[model samples]
Target: MMSQYKSVFKDETKLDINYVPYKLPHRDRELRLLTEFFSFILHAPGKMAQRIVIAGDVGSGKTVLSQRFGMNATREAEKRGINLHYVHVNCREYRGSLFLILYHAVSVFHPSFPKRGYSAEELLQILLQVLDEQDAYVILTLDEFESLIEREGTEAVYKLTRLQETRVNKPQRLSLICVMRNLKILEKLDASTRSTLQSNVIHLEKYSKRQLVDILSDRVSLAFKPLTVPEDTVSLIADIASSEGGNARFGIELLWRAGKYADADDLNVVTPECVRKAASSIYAVMRKSEAAYLSLHEKLFLLGIARFFKESERAYASLAEAEQAYAVVCEEFNVKPRSHTQLWKYLRTLSAVGFVKTEVSENIGSRGRSTIIYLPRISAHELEKELTALLEKDV
Candidate 1:
């Protein structure tokens, strides 16, 4: 088994979602902005910490940049003898309720805090008490914070931001860096909470193709052996990522997957074709839990769409074409086909999860309207293969 295993990756974790590079490229301005905003913490230790919102699209480096600043702040505070600690939380993970969020945060300071038998208010008191005793400053970086606000309401956000103003002996101890995909979520917050965070929002723009190439080149050198990745292969992955909305994470994943493909085929160097293969199977990036939740007919519908697009060699196909192909797929597998309306519903579901792209075509149709559909990130052939394997496992 050991002899059979082969991989070009020197350290695969570099491709991980949690990996933070030592040096962040194309983000100097954002980092400088964060440093400037938080500079008061170092200049005046007891002064209230800044509350800021960081908004950006997925894979735009929001989490990593904020995290790097948090790390730097911790070190700088220690050098200045400031009683400061940085706690990072992904609100999506700790989002059972507001009580759960406070429990996790307070537990950082009070390790013995009970995991149960506490109300949200009680947990808040415990957290405040611990903060009062420690008399330390904290910068809480809440990532995917929109989920928390959406699920539990903005009560927690308002309380944390108002920590200083709410008390007579407020330690000026807490500040917030709430990371979100967009400020549009702010619409859901209480007007006061919305107004409080309105002034200090940092927006991270998506990376351009050239920036993505540079980002991937940096990771490739760090992740693979010298000469294992050719320069053109980097460009190919960058092009694919650019087409998919300039997500650097997608580009990095393509490079990692391409290398894995090369190694699996016993190739010496990653090639453009390997990148294409990687790009053709990008839906493999979907979380298994999400995939598991897909209904069997939904999966079959996707496989039909995949097979049609694979055969057509086009980025898109008509609904009529998809329906006809889907019926053929149903016949082949001895699976009963759903109505056209049901297939349309399945297409909508697939689109919601980023699996399929659907749009109204300008060309006139027999029915006077037609929707064109295609897989967004992967080729139909690859999707067919993946869906076939997935459905087989389900069986």
Candidate 2:
């Protein structure tokens, strides 16, 4: 029998690094821009690193660009004999504790990394001491920076900003690249501090379809056999990414998934149709980070609804079936199942978070209507995987 996808599946468990681009697209422009911006700090005699903020919607390619800039900064610093201790950390992952982040910062530049028995303040002192001794400028890039305020409030944020205000007979020489997923990062800062951040705002816009197409096409050469990926693969991936709100990560992921499907079916050629089949699952998981923070009971409730609809194949699932399925998941997780009213409220929360769609439909015989919960896409397995990963991190 002829199979649809046979050739591309060398290893299903292959790491995703193969798909991630090492260098950013049109990255030289950003590198030059940031170089010029950092020049303001690097040239500032011992105390003038102005605050810079990077703003973009989720998946708009901010972090990747920032890292590329970070890499360039290190290269330039070395060329000019400028001492710089570069550190990159994602705040969302580190939002639970300021110490975890500082630990990461100290650990990056120091061989020992001071793993045992240091308070956050102690770690900061050690980091600054290293900086003073080395006469090094610090270029720290903090991604998902808004999470700091959301999770721990403003004490850390204000304190860190204060560090930038220090002067050795000049301005605070430390530079920071702060990334936020939303504009509210502006509101979180005081007026004087926001003014410093405003001077260096770099907005990473969503990728255009052509941009995503080019990205996927370029990677295809490195990732797959020549002429193996059909032309429509680019458009298929681009359309899905754009329709899902211009998510570059989503585009990269869909291409990865389509390759798998093609390989599994023993097809030598990757086609748009394969990507079409794979994108639903990709979209499902792309939004799971938002779901991860929901209460476990809420997750079980959503899981129950997802299982029911997945089994039923209809958009609208009966509350009765959903409740039963939910109960099963709660028992498996060893958590108490909530009542129907509480479950419905959970459904509303999920909808608000864009996990599921909901509608009201009348029963065949009953006078009143029941709430019908619908999956945002055909399957939410990816979503489940995302939430599970996030929960696992907390555990």
Q: Which residue pairs come into collision in candidate 1?
A: none
What tens digits encode model 2's per-residue C-alpha lDDT throughout 1-395?
96443466343333253233566674456657777877755555365664678887766778777776777677767777877766778888886467887778777668777578977767766777777777777888877887766775566666566674444453354568888877676677777666656777887777776787777776676667677777656665675677677877777777788887777666777655456457665544444456767887777777777666545533356678778988987786777778878987887888887666666666888698887665544344554555456545543
Q: Write the per-residue lDDT of candidate 1 for residues 229-319, one digit (tens) a residue.
A: 8886787577667767788888888889989888987887886556656776664565556656789888888888878766654445688
Candidate 1 regions exceeding 4 Å error are: 1-6, 284-395
In candidate 2, list every pair of residues with a backbone clash.
5-265, 5-266, 5-267, 6-265, 6-266, 6-267, 47-171, 285-383
Highest-TM-score candidate: 1
lDDT value, candidate 2, whole model: 0.68
For each candidate, the alpha-carbon lDDT, in order, equals 0.80, 0.68
Q: Quote the positional error of residue 73 for candidate 1 in Å.
A: 1.1
Give all TM-scores, in the order shown: 0.71, 0.65
